[model samples]
Target chain A: MSEYTATVTVRLKAGVHDPEAETTRRALERLGFDLSALRAADQFELDLDAESAESARERATEMTERLLANPTIHDHDIEVEPR
Target chain B: MSEYTATVTVRLKAGVHDPEAETTRRALERLGFDLSALRAADQFELDLDAESAESARERATEMTERLLANPTIHDHDIEVEPR
Candidate 1:
């Protein structure tokens, strides 16, 4: 087995309310940045041991489903590469 | 001016305590994923208007410095593309 790093990007599903993003946009506007709209996401990077990139991705996907992302309101993508 | 989208990825600086990331890693480990270490970040996407991509990037960078990222403990990257 080899060490690998998995990158998971979790984003709110379309139509989901994102108060943090809204608050961030307001803060930017107050600071004089002309932003019309905004959205936000959570990214998680995990280090693990796996036999191959494909296996690493599989573990990352399962991890996202179980903890890294809330499937009811979030969607996620996983990328794995050798560490 | 044209509409553009800016993607900002904000991550904790090295040595910062990341409780949320720790909790996530614990949850994943509980689910049988053998992770060694983990880090987490917040990503923000903004829609705005600018004269060009360069201008858009400049605005996004300013936003990151002032709002999207906390320079004291966070590092960020900004990417802008025409919408």
Candidate 2:
């Protein structure tokens, strides 16, 4: 087994309401920062043992489907690298 | 002005307490995934008009300093791309 790090990024799907991003945009505008749009996402990094990068990515994808992301409203991507 | 997108990632500084990450690690472990460590971060994507990518990066850096991250306990990185 090789040490691997999987980075999973989860974001609300397009057209989904994102209150946090909206609030952040408003706050930036109030601070005089001009922005047209904003979006927010959560990134999780997991360190684990796996046989290959593909296997690590598969595990990360499973984790995302099981817990990190809500499939009904979220879209996620995963990247894996050897550690 | 050219349109640009700024991506800012904010993470807790090393040695800083991260309750959410700790909880996630435990949850994943219970699910039978063996992991050595886990960490979580917030990523913000901002679309705005700027004269250059440098300006966009500067604005995003300012946003991170002002609202997106707590300097005392968090560290951040910003990337800007022309849109």
Candidate 3:
């Protein structure tokens, strides 16, 4: 098995309520910061020992779909790299 | 002033406690997947109206330093684009 690292990014689906982003925008505007648009996303990095790159990708995708992400309201992208 | 978009990426300091990233890594390992390295980060997209790119960047940087990030425990990179 080889060492691998995975970076996963997760974000709220468009149309979802993003109170934190909204609040930040409003605060900036109040401070005369000329705010226009705002969005928020999360990223995760993982270290893994996998038999192969392809196998790691498959496992990461499955983990994302089943555990790491809320499929009903979030979207995620995964990138795996050999460590 | 012109409309602009700012994409900000925030990440934990190298030694900070990252329970979420750690938990996710463990989950991946439990599933019989090879695990290597893991990191966690956040992304923020902001829209702004500013007299110029330089001014906007300055304001955004200040905002990031004062509110959007905890400088002691997080580091951030910002990208500004015409909207």
Q: For each candidate, what TM-score against the reference?
A: 0.94, 0.97, 0.81
lDDT of 1 by residue, B2-75 (tens): 99999999999989999988887887778777888999988888899999999989888887887677789998
Superposed Cα deviation of residue B56, candidate 2 (Å): 0.8
Best by TM-score: 2
What are the runs in model 1 whose C-alpha is more than 4 Å off? none
Query: Order of candidates by TM-score, top first?
Result: 2, 1, 3
Across A1-83, the per-residue lDDT of candidate 1 in tens digits comes to 99999989999999999888888778877877777899998888899999999998988888888777788999888888899
lDDT score at residue A8, model 2, on the 0-100 scale: 95
**Lowest-sum lDDT 10-residue window in model 2 chain A:** A27-36
Question: What's the CA error at residue B14 for candidate 3, in Å?
Answer: 0.8
> Could you give the CAPRI-style class of model 3?
medium
C-alpha lDDT (0 to 100) for residue B34 of candidate 2: 80
Badly placed stretches (over 4 Å) of model 3 are A1-3, A49-55, A81-83, B51-54
Model 3's TM-score against the true structure? 0.81
lDDT of each: 0.87, 0.92, 0.81
Q: Write the per-residue lDDT of candidate 3 for residues B1-83, one digit (tens) a residue.
A: 88877778899998999898888767767875555566778898877788888877887798788678898999899988888
Higher-TM-score candidate of 1 and 3: 1
Which model, 1 or 2, shows the larger lDDT? Answer: 2
